[model samples]
Target: MLTDVLKPEKTTRKNAKPIWLMRAGAASELETSVQDWVDASAFKAGAGTVLVVPDRKPGGIAGAVLGLGDGDDPFVSGALASKLPAGDWFFDSPSTADIRLASLGFLMGAYRFARYRKFPEERPSLILDGSLDRSELVALAEAVWLARDLVNTPANDLGPDGIEAAARLVAKDRKMSVRVVKGGELQKKNFPLIHAVGQASQSAPRLIDMRWGRRGAPRLTLVGKGVSFDSGGLDIKPASGMRNMKKDMGGAANILALARLVIDARLDVRLRVLIPAVENAISGSAFRPGDIYRSRKGLTVEIGNTDAEGRLVLADAIALADEEKPDMILDMATLTGAARVALGPDVPPFFTTDDAFADSLSAASLIEHDPVWRLPLWAPYLRGLSSGVADLCNVTTDGFAGSVTAALFLQQFVTGAKSWAHFDIFAWNPVAKPHAPVGGEAHAIRAIFAALRQRYGVTRN
Candidate 1:
């Protein structure tokens, strides 16, 4: 999809503009003519600043210069795709790592939601001459763009059926196996929690199960919460809070993004993707706050709040994922507002019982620029989720630790997996950054993918 954004070549054209990257106060070291032009233009090399120098020949761009502020973060180069004039461009760098990072930034920056903007902008193409692997970077950009597109679409166009359609498309594209249990089949299948959450909507609730890779490979299961639109059922959210509810299915979009990376890279993993698709809308049949539903895992959970439906759907899905006794289980959800309050929108909070997996994921997060922070699955918080009648409630009544208790609530259904982690992600970029535009965003999957690849990387003899 976005593969064309990056062009691989044995050599770059002489006319291709060389982008000279610099930190503050580094412009004085440039060649005499370029330095004079930069100085004359008062280019201070501030972060995200770009200035195109004119060639000695009239009206032509000789090259461009970019500012990196402290030179610590290379992703500032991301803005170059939109800021630079349409033409061929190459980074004037000797370091492989910087080039790689800068290239990634450029590829992501090239994204434009063309669905609504029918006319395409004249885009600049990055020319690479043996600096990086084009395939992996292209795969990352394509997957991220796919997730963003799904997240940015309005709820009218993206409902429960829309989410299921997306999963079906992936299965067809990859030629993988897919099985769906929908409507009354969900009831017959014993997915009581998932059905209860969506029974109020016209679109039926369903579980999308997709599998890929060899049967004997290490099992890696991914579960995503697919609440297409959360009207909060009978407990409706205020207008302001419900305005962006379309992005509620962000967790499902991100799981598909990561699944693309895993399958495209041909990793040595037997992957199972489980998506519980539903729409939490209000109606006469809507499940009430005090209602208790027996999950597919046979754990009774009292509905403490109607707005906490993400975990309800995911509980059944994750319980199903654990049934296979997979080596790892990772579920991502736009489950709680408290997560945003705790870490803001950019840094998601992940909870896991495995120390080694946490350390590996943390390391990968920084390297991949997909930030995630670890929150404890505090056993003491288990008391916060305790219920008087049922086995456990969906949320803590005191609300002292909303995000922590949410993770603990999901952790109850994951006893069978060797290692399990829950990613409480925002999945939406409320504010625009140099690289990421505002709307549905792909978070944490890159880092998670990198870690999984390292753990189960295929070795060919």
Candidate 2:
């Protein structure tokens, strides 16, 4: 259950009602009454105008209006959650409006990473009118919350085992079945790359598998990189580079969050989630930079740089996902610094060979307001990953197109999926935004969810 904030002094309609409104370009006929009230009333707040208005219509009660001073900023619609009075309120408008994205955004925007500290005050609540499906909205919010919570938890408590445990807990909560292949089990499962990277850690390495939805539905496979903490293994990172390595597994957190949404929405698809959980820690037994390992896909990879271990683990997980020959495969990872360099921290870069799939995802981002940009899976970049003695190298020899090369490496492992998409997300908001506090964030999950919903339609709980 989510927390709500409501003041006793605030005026309410017939039922202690709460709703969110958008102030657009010039007041329309629909908003004429509200606009007149705002012009007449004097409020102290500047940007986010939260006030209860009188609604004397037949079944209507008091309504809440959120101020978007300038109509130019599109992100303002979702940022209203931070300013409104705290309470579990629903939207006052009809559900026919395409505002599910804003509903999810409101929940995500109001989110604060509070494990390290307490919030100064309660956040506002949101309620949607009878139009949109409540369960789908809640599922989307919960999934994003899970991603933020797992990524925000300090590395000390969220190591490899802890990550696996979190996935299991979510599986149990959703009444889904899960299987964990850990430590020696990796050898049995034939996921050598996943085991090699995690063997050096005391926490042990694990591959988390979760299944949900009807058995006969279309299969949709999701793989996430779960390097809980990256000390850069034997290669070692500079102090600055290592500072936020705890968020290295942010890819895994985001995927699990998306998985939660899929199950909660009950989408008409057979969902499979694979998270290769590991910690790239330094130790005497840690896999060395020159080591060569066989992947589950049967391709041999030479470790050019230990820091490029996220793809290695994901390679095995993707191979496993491919074996199912799913309709689509989506893998998320905080895999490359180059992606951040190209798009900065907020917009993640995704790669896919299927044109229709790419368009669907791109359009869904615009509709959902959880934007992700597309980067080509340039076939020419395949040469950058060539190895003298192995099928490929984990990194590029000249250090160019790091994100592209990383995507190319993972592509080698995907064989049977009809369509595949890879996301290189920063997954952390360095600075605070209205809905997102400065901490681990779920960058592309919402966009992907929107695409899924469009493809398969929403499934209610």
Q: Pick the candidate with the highest TM-score.
A: 1
Error of 2 at 434 (Å): 1.2
Please, what is the TM-score per model? 0.97, 0.87
Which regions of candidate 1 fall more than 4 Å away from where they truly are?
A: 1-4, 8-14, 27-29, 459-461
**Per-model C-alpha RMSD:** 1.6, 4.4
Q: What tens digits encode model 1's per-residue C-alpha lDDT throughout 1-461?
A: 46455665654576678888778965355678888898899888888789999997789898898888865677788889889998888987877887888888888777777777664546778886475787888788888898999998877888888998888887787867999999889989999999999999988889999999888888999999999999998889999989999989999999999999999888888899999999999988899999998999999999999999999999999999999999999999999999999999999999998889899989998888889999988889899888999999998889788999999999999988999999999988888777788888999988999989888996231
lDDT, candidate 2, equals: 0.81
**Can you list the residue pairs that collide in candidate 1?**
none
Clashes of 1: 0
Find the 10 residues in a row with the least total lDDT in model 2. 4-13
**What are the per-residue Cα lDDT tens digits for candidate 2 across 368-406?**
678799997888989988889998889998978889989
